[model samples]
Target: MRTQVAIIGSGPSGLLLGQLLTDAGIDNVILERATQDYVLGRIRAGVLEEGMAGMLDEAGAGARMRREGLPHDGFDLTFSARHHRIDLFGLTGKHVIVYGQTEVTRDLMDRRAQTGGVTVYEAANVQPRDFDGAQPYVTYEQDGIEHRLYCDFIAGCDGYHGPSRKAVEGRGLETFERVYPFGWLGIVADVPPVSHELIYSNHPRGFALCSMRSNTRSRYYVQCALDEKVEEWPDERFWDEIRRRLPTETAEKMTTGPSIEKSIAPLRSFVAEPMRFGRLFLVGDAAHIVPPTGAKGLNLAASDVRYLFDGVREHYAEKSDAGIDVYSQRALRRVWKAERFSWWMTNTMHCFPEQGAFGQRIQEAELDYLAGSVAASTSLAENYVGLPY
Candidate 1:
């Protein structure tokens, strides 16, 4: 098979790119190593930055999101047994949409199907070949047959563990990574959320986040040791721990239920420099990863797709290489800012193992200042609403 672009990975990043390109009359195909059901089954963060919501609209996958996604102008931050609200919309004139990543993927996949775009699921041993040279192609095995896809360019939209990033090995690429000493034990339950908007709390024990996927489905997380296992946390124990971390009022109103999904996700901040090499471009987690503290992972992926789509569109529409030429620089600029924000959020909200009492005092002071000062609140609001694209 031959195409204009071959996108490796059918996650949101790859699928969004395919949708944009296909809508623009450019031909592309997506390849995934997992079945569609498995892909959608993975639970992920739901906070949607303003820019990401806009991109979904551009891809013609916004109707359901706009209809069902909850819009929030503010979120609560609890510290010192008090609740402080960050008026995101009031301070930044922008708001976020609380739409699950799963829903976003479904919308994009449905749109892709309706538009007649091709996505190959369960593709095995998928590899990008000859990306550095002009005639780039991808190879993979499917159903006992070896298949080759010739393309003008290859998009590595695969995640961190995927082959896309590794393909750039031996090339002059630098990587920066910091793995946190802790993880977040998250649970999804069928109960009304304790609060209307998300609440991020810092207590003597640990950090906790109260979030929701919908009106009746709550998603919550509590920081845990890196060595902690999901099996160690039963539903009752998880709820008890969550309540201990929240403010008294909020905790009193919280509803408890059997967890439908539970897992522990390690925290890490990783970035690969020069998101492009020859004809291959790294998009989303293939290029960078941020801790979920600030909810930047999925939004960063969408922004990367936006930058890449702009460059690709420019290349095809105007026969101009200028956009693609500067794609790496443009994308990296935004990537670094997000990395900094996510790192800062993690440091401020979580209790570091080595952060002695002095560090704890400083964290408390910072939170107090952030709650009392309009400037500090605005800064938080702006970053939470998302930096401009």
Candidate 2:
């Protein structure tokens, strides 16, 4: 098989990139080792920056999101049992849409199908080969048969654990990471949110976030020990714990119910340097990861796609390699900024056992300063809504 681009993994990044290429008259095919049902079953963050929303619109997949996604101009920051609103739109003139990542993937998948694009589910042992040379191709096994796919370029949107990143491991691939001491015990329930907008709370117990997937489906999380198990938290216990972390009034107003889904995810900030390796390029989680404190994961993926798509499109449309040549630098610049924000937010909201009371005091002072200073507040708002792509 031959195509202009061979995309590994059918996650949002891979699917979005393929869809963009197909619409631009570029041939591409997606290879996924997992079934379509398994792909959509994975739960992910829903916060969408204006930049990502625009990309979805550009790909002709924004109608459903525009109709169903919730847009927020601001969110509340809680500390000392007091709520302070960070006016994202008022401060930066931009707001984010609360749309589930799964929905985003679904929309992209639907659009791809409509456009007659190719995506192979359950493709086995997918591997990128000869990316360092002028010619690049992918190899995979399917239905107990082995095949090769030749392509002009390879997109490593296969994520951190996928073969794309591992393929170039010994070829000067440097990585950096910091794992937090805590994890978030999250639950999705069929209930209205406690507030119309999201609430990020800092408490002595830990950090908590009140978010939602839709008007009727609320998602909530509370910080837990890294070793904590899901079995330790029943629905009733989870509700009680989250309420205890919120302000009295907000907790009183919150509606509790039996959770439909539950999980615990450890927080980490990671980045792999130099996103491009010859004819192969990394997009999204393959290149970087954030702590999810500022909701930057999916947005960073969109940013990478923007750079790569522009570069790849230019290569064909104008016979230029300038964009692709600098994909790493451009994407890394934004990736580092987001990493910094996520790190800072995590430090500010989360309790560090080693830092003790001193850290607590410093965090209190930081939030208090933001509450009083327009400059500090605007900085937070700018990062929260997302910086320019």
Q: Give lDDT tens digits, candidate 2, residues 266-329.
A: 9999999899999999999999989888999999999999999999999999999999999999
Clashes of 1: 0
Colliding residue pairs in candidate 1: none
Clashing pairs in 2: none
Regions of model 2 farther than 4 Å from truth: none
Over the full model, what C-alpha lDDT does candidate 1 score relative to the true structure? 0.94
1-389, model 1: which lDDT tens digit per residue? 99999999999999999999999999999999999999999889989999999999999999999999999999999998988999998999999999999999999999999999999999999999999899999999999999999998899999999998999987999999999999999999999999999999988789999999999999999999999889899999999999999988899999999999999999999999999999999999999999999999999999999989999999999999888989899999999999999999999999899987888788889999999899999988888889998
RMSD of each: 0.7, 0.6
Instruction: Report how far off residue 322 is in candidate 2 (Å).
Output: 0.7
How close to the true structure is residue 27 of candidate 2, measured as C-alpha lDDT?
Answer: 94
